[model samples]
Target: MVLTPSSAPSRAPSYAAVLRTPHAACPFAAALLGRLSYGVAPLSLLLALKDATGSYSVAGVAMALFGAASVTLSPARAALIDRYGPRRVLPPMAGLYAALLTVIALATWNPGAPALLLGGLTMAAGACTPPLGPVMRALWSSLVPDRELLQRAYSLDGVAEELMYVTAPLLVGIVVTFTEPAAGVLAGAVLVFVGASALVSSPAVSRAHTARPPAGGPAGPRLHGIAALRHAVLVTAAVGLCLGALDLLVVAFTERLHQAAAVSWVLAALSAGSAVGGLAYGAVRWKSSSRVRLPVVAAALGAALLVAGVSPHLYALVAVVAVAGLFVAPALTTAYLIADESVDAARRTQAGAWVNTAFNAGSSGGTAVVGLLVDRLPIALCFGLAAAPALVCAAAVARAGARRPRTAGTGAAGRDAVSGA
Candidate 1:
């Protein structure tokens, strides 16, 4: 049952039809729960550290270390899942991650605990975190073999992720306000364990465990051999850089207005716009190649972000950001589709992980750069600087499109290679 575009029917399926397939619910729910925790954990960790240490610097350091550890370890963890399957990989790792978080929370509760110890614990927790996002993407490919339906599934996934991004912070905020920061962290731990357990136990995931590699071939492709994957990663990283800058810019904008509480609303508007855009993009079939679409959307995103950077008032900025956000998820969805179609079946999870890594790295770099600029320059300048990455991404995508036809062969072989041949 190796699925390919050639084998799927020509007619496109509705998203409702796709979701109605047997055994869809368990995996979808589990993936969503795990994703929510993924969104919630970072802020929870930061708040917990700040509560314990009474210094934003210490909290930032701990959070940065956690992110660094995850970025470094994600590819290796995803590779393991590809080789051994989620049933064997996810449950143990999820349990270990939860236990580590529990330990970090206990340490946070101990007011005298050293900051270094807490930072180390958070890093360890991040390293062991389950590769839920990559796994879920891989599962969708298996669940829906129709090319058109899969695109819709990915769009739905993107929309759900945006919702999580909007909701998780509020959830963390509520927990922190009512209970304690450590409770928020502990809540994330509980979600991770519960979600991972359900995902691993699902029949679909269990079947994926026995999924064999390409016949008479190895379990994965050589990374250096794939041009599409390399380009996809680069494009995705650039998008991430702009997003990182936007995150900080919003904070700076709210702080300058002395309405710090408004930051969440501004960010949520962006996510909401992305959610709407993703649904629309997924619903319609595109005649152009993904490579072409990638650059066009990236350029539009850069243009919109440039406008947001210069907005004169809080209301104006929020409106611009919302408009800018319409392009964000579509760009990412394009990147994921490029990666999915570029790699061999056995390497799909690994390819997705690489995309995630690029985004995280870009976001980290963007945040650091914007953080430095915020102290020295006007916030508008910082916003303009953020737009730089999106422009670079557009250029990179255009260059990749130019090179694709030359390096890719003609007819079936070339098409297969380009489309996960």
Candidate 2:
């Protein structure tokens, strides 16, 4: 069933042919819009709650509740999509998100109702979060006939992810700062509802649904679950945990310095560094499989974490963080690629969801642990704590390499052949 350029359709496509293609530019555009909407909600929720309650602590709590709910429900939501097509499920989910957003806006203006409405809205929205990345990946797999084209497609996706975080927040911030922050939340809800609906309605997505195998047939290769149990997955999860710990460490440092506003600048610097790294990695012609690249990048990340822990000054910490972040996209992209390569085509969505869930769970756990450390000891200790777990992750990866040896000669070919959903 392996596909190649020689097996592709013979004519230059007309508009109809382009429209019917499973993976096309339009679907990618739709995915971008949907992700943009999801990114805007957090800032909006915090602002709306703060404006109404005049309690920053209460607003923070509301945000936490929303995150908790999303973390708990996202897997079930993803599973539902696996059982039923996204086209059938997305519209109603989007509609639910819109209605709950209205409820949150109403609650913001009313003092009687609790801020819990905001949390509920966040959970609903997150639960219904369009499987944009997964869906697009699947589409690309179906449409493109060549492995090189798929790599290029995934590289484009990596670029889109960087763009989403960059532009999404700035635009959201502008709207929130100028108009009512609640308006920003309303806008995000509308975008989610509209964008997701449009994506599902697209001919590309519809075709994927129609292409499903018979219900009772033996399912496609289940790579994600198998990959999840592998050492690579554990190492990747550990990397996520380290990043989360780093986040808490920054917060602790800011609090200790009594310049909490610096958090925004520091985080931005780290993100900027990651953007650079992603671009660099995407551009390079590496002769190594994802297995080789992942462990090496992760070990490098651990070393960077070690440096961050030892650094005393804020400037030094920022530098180290930026350095570490430079490889963030490559690490994430590789981990996802591995997950996709391991799973069956039909089960790709579920596998992707599981990978997302694992990363989130690891990060949340890291945040909790680091937060506790910050509360108990000096802020410097928080940064130091980040390195310990990173070292452990590095060790786990090294051990995995010893146990499941990879031939150096086949590495490049294996990496080049990466086929993602």
Candidate 3:
């Protein structure tokens, strides 16, 4: 049976409803595992590379390259999901990721071409990039009958992400210190493969990918990619730009402190804050769009940036990082919700992918810009400059709010039907 939003009941699902089916739980569990494992690999690789080479710069280079690869390929990955089913794509990717980890481990053991090749392979295998985030979002959209539940789901996702950042690095550090970084990487590989494979095997995910029914009468019109891009979405995309900048600012902050070893801690602080914000936002019963949350988040982020820019002490810097992160997930959750509601259900995934793509691009671009600023100016100046994007984002949100109608489901249904086709 097709589950459309229009057919959903008015009442919220009771605790009994939540318990009656196991499907709702599957995506959340899968998300937890996938996020945890993914978090470990980067921490392990960075620590291992830096320890072996005694060069934080080299570690940065490795990370930059990995991010570059992922950013470059993310859209193509989404397109592939659009074409081939996610089920067919994720498992092999997991296996290949495991092989690459083994190669990296061997490379660390011997430090040679085989390891280098594997590292490069790992980067290129963006083709197999696990669809954990997208798939989870899809499952949430399907399983939850209420829009509020969907909002809560994304908020919970943000919280889980925060928890991963909080613990993954420490775990990676401990494992590497007691044994070896290679061991930690290997463990991450194992967890990723196991968890991702299990998620792919779940009935809900499999059905969502393959259950496209035959169309009656012209199949309507395919949603023009351009038409799918709404002004609200465009505004929220700018918030992503700020986040990208913030990610880089944190890295640059660690470098300026000459405590490059603790860069991940700064990142964790940001993630933790975001997770807290998401959880808190999710708990609230507001039905407003990004119109409501975007400004609040933007103001918080701007203030945090100001503090980070001016603070001279490391503890103060960390505090500002946490404060800055406080708004990140909330802003992002708002963006996702806006994008989801703005587009047609059929085009929902594409819209969601567009948001992800924008965020990734923003992050990479923001980091590169901040990194250059750090080289040319004071760290304070770099941190201060990061706020510019957030300010721009806030302006865009205000403009969109002014133009947008108060309710989403009015005349937009005709527009959405045209688009969703």
* Deviating ranges (above 4 Å) for candidate 3: 1-22, 49-60, 114-119, 210-269, 311-320, 344-347, 378-380, 404-408, 411-421
Task: Please give, for residues 1-421, the per-residue lDDT of candidate 2 as tens digits.
Answer: 1111223344333333333445487777787787787678778877888887778888888777777666666657665666687888777877887777766766775444565655566566555555566666666655664444455555557666776877777987799667777787788778777778777877877777667554324544433336432645676677778888888787777777787888777777778877777766654445455655677777778788778777777788788888988867777766666665655556556656655666667788888888778788765566666666656765766566557544443344343223332
Full-model lDDT for every candidate: 0.80, 0.67, 0.64
Two-way lDDT contest, 2 vs 3, winner: 2
lDDT tens per residue, model 1, 1-421:
1112334335667779768867776798898998888878888889889989988999988888899889989999998998888988899999999999989888886466788888889889989988898998888877776666777888888899889877898898898778878887888899999998998889998775466466226534443337667877887888889988889989988998898899888988888889988887777666555656777777788888889878888899889888888888888887777777777677778888998899889989988889889989987777888898788878876875667544334333223343333
The candidate that achieves the highest TM-score relative to the unseen native structure: 1
Q: What is the lDDT of candidate 3?
A: 0.64
Worst 10 residues of 3 by lDDT: 412-421
Backbone steric clashes in candidate 2, count: 5
Candidate that scores best on lDDT = 1
Work out the TM-score per prediction.
Answer: 0.91, 0.83, 0.79
Q: Give the TM-score of candidate 1.
A: 0.91
Give the lDDT ranking, best first.
1, 2, 3
Misplaced by over 4 Å in model 1 are 1-11, 214-225, 257-260, 406-421
